[model samples]
Target: MKNKYNLLLSLMVFLFSACSTKDEVNIPSDVTNLRAEARAGSIMLRWDNPSDLNFLYVPVQFKNPLTGAIIKTNVSYLTDSLLIDDILAKDGEYTFEIYTVGEGGERGGNTLQVSCTALPRTPVVTEHAEKIDFQVSALSANASDPTEGNLANLIDGDLKTHYHTNWHEKIPFPQWIQFDLKEPVEGVKFVSWNRNGSNNANAEEVYITGSNDGENWVEIGRILPDELPTTGGAKFESKMFYKQDMTFTKIRYNAKSGVGGKAWFSIAELEWYKTWVVVVDPERN
Candidate 1:
């Protein structure tokens, strides 16, 4: 009978010990630094790190507040290593929150809020561009390489374009590359950014030249940014075309200069500026 009692007591002790295991996730700091940047027609989400946690040991999930769309991914050491690009947002209010994934987890992560004017202004083709068989070839350089590229290298120039060759290289200037529109208008009126150089003085250069027949360029204007490269090499997508109707063919954008001070300039797309709000008929609302 004493043996039986001891065995029962031992079982109770074992069960209690099993239920009291130390939590594997030690959330020292959480408050995901979520940031939202609006560019072109897309909005980018930059979130803080849940990274230091175990890789395969624990999985993370991202949920969309509107659609409830959930994405499962692993959290490593890289911060904001994930991007949400499903953009169906209109001009309104939106909010998103992040919750930590536990081992069958509990809520302890980060949350952030941002407001955006998710609208874009596209230009009305005054004259439909007659497609020309033109291809642009770009050549570039840094403090390390200095031979800049051309329209063919930056963008396919055969389409009806608005700018031509624009090249601007200077001291204390960001390294850049550009696509010159063959047509001429005003100047670079819009300023949006994606992946810029590595510093606050955004190391990107944009200059202008004027031409009529897509050849014979002349320097006219430029836009030098004041930003830097991402500390992490994240893919940046930004656009800063034009807003008011101007005239110029030869527009140039240079990025990632040999110039130092945390700068790099990368562009995925560039377009001509057109007014975002257009009234077809003033009398009709």
Candidate 2:
């Protein structure tokens, strides 16, 4: 009877220890250093590793503030960062939560709460009309003759052909090509393609000026060879948005020199963006 009592006591002790171990293994410690950064169209989440080794996975939850919809993701313990993209939330505040899943599927307390806002989308624009019939002038050049080099070539939209100034006939510095947009534009952006030749002759400095009339021009944008590579491909330049969109009927491009001292200012193609406003007629409707 004494031996049997000792054996029974040993079995009870082992059972109690097993249960205690299981309980301890199923509880997870909290995660630390959770952070979220708002980007152009997404949010980046980062965090430090959990102190406890009992966690099996980390589950992140995103909530839509307007629709009350939920998005859930499960990540392994090894993942310390994640980027959530294409979130169709409007320009407003949103929240997210993180929780740690223990070995036995038990979830620990909430680790962190994060809030961020989506940025406003940029406006869409399309190609506008190019002024092909405009006056061309420089300090001196052969721009008058259509057969040789003319201002119309700038807006011809043909990359194979370009407008080249007569460098041998006159000095190439401080050349300009001006045109009438015919109609006023709400806003404008410019793109220029350099002449693609053996030497890759391109503009070293270009200035964009706008005016309501043919005279009294105002500088709206500037492009340098450093900012816009004057070789290989076309260079795109954008104008800064003003307090209110301005209207301009005349646009001019003034060139100072050629990239790498190529002796002339040559442009293959020039394009511009114009904001168009649509008018609805109530009588026709």
Candidate 3:
């Protein structure tokens, strides 16, 4: 009986140890940048496809970004990407769970939970910050689709998808693209780039402007070389500041500025930004 008791105790200890042992779970460390763009009353959620992941069944959750309460019914797709209508989200904290769905729907995600709330989407600048949640810049390869050339979302590095719905015959030189910010913008960042280490007919120039509506525009900044160099296309960002509380909504840049009268550019990207840090002046005696 003594021997049996000892054996039972040992078995219990072994089982507890096994249970306590940290089992390696599939939790992606790479922050999957997610963004929701509100278009025609719908919120499109786009995030990076997890690496080293074969197939993912993500249980995408979203709520009032204000309150921590769980929003219902948004528990939708296990798809590679998710696009849900705004009507589904309550409006506080928008959370997502990527289910590492393997063969037979074997789940392995959300074991280590991660979340970000979706408030009113209001960007208010404080003393330290220009605006709350003012996405300074993002560095994610998956932000834009390589093949389709589409972009989406503001922060969390979701690419705002845009391209010539169809290919052009001439492949228009000095390609130009623009973006429309929903709210009032006071800062514009001209993000433009071209191919690396290959200057053939690659001539690229860039310009910037702002506006109240999406139509009327005005030049706010410009960048050009003193003289056109033999091998140097525009490759940098110019942080432009806007004053007078002017509401801006459009972004336009030279896509493929012709070089030596013959060369079109395959623009890698053009990122735009908006910062509203309003100051209220007080009179002093």
Best by TM-score: 2
A best-first ranking of the candidates according to their TM-score comes to 2, 3, 1
Which stretches of candidate 3 lie above 4 Å from their native place? 1-168, 171-174, 201-203, 226-235, 243-245, 276-285
Arrange candidates, best lDDT first.
2, 3, 1
**TM-score winner between candidates 2 and 3:** 2
C-alpha lDDT of all candidate models, in order: 0.41, 0.66, 0.46
How does each model score on TM-score?
Answer: 0.33, 0.51, 0.35
Indicate the residue-level lDDT of 8 in model 1.
Answer: 100
Expressed as tens digits, the lDDT of each residue in 1-285 for candidate 1 is 999999999999988777665545444445366666765434565666545552222234445545676656555334453444434344243454444544444445454455543334333333222221223442223322233223333243222221212234333443434444444444443333332232233344455344444455555545454433333222332333342454555444444342244333333224344222334421121
- lDDT (tens digit, per residue) of candidate 3 on 200-264: 44433555666666568777766564332334334555555564646666555543355555434
Higher lDDT: candidate 2 or 3? 2
- Candidate 1, RMSD to the unseen true structure: 18.7
Q: Where's the lowest-lDDT run of ten residues in candidate 3?
A: 136-145
Local lDDT at 19 for model 2:
95
lDDT computed for candidate 1: 0.41
Error of 3 at 185 (Å): 0.5
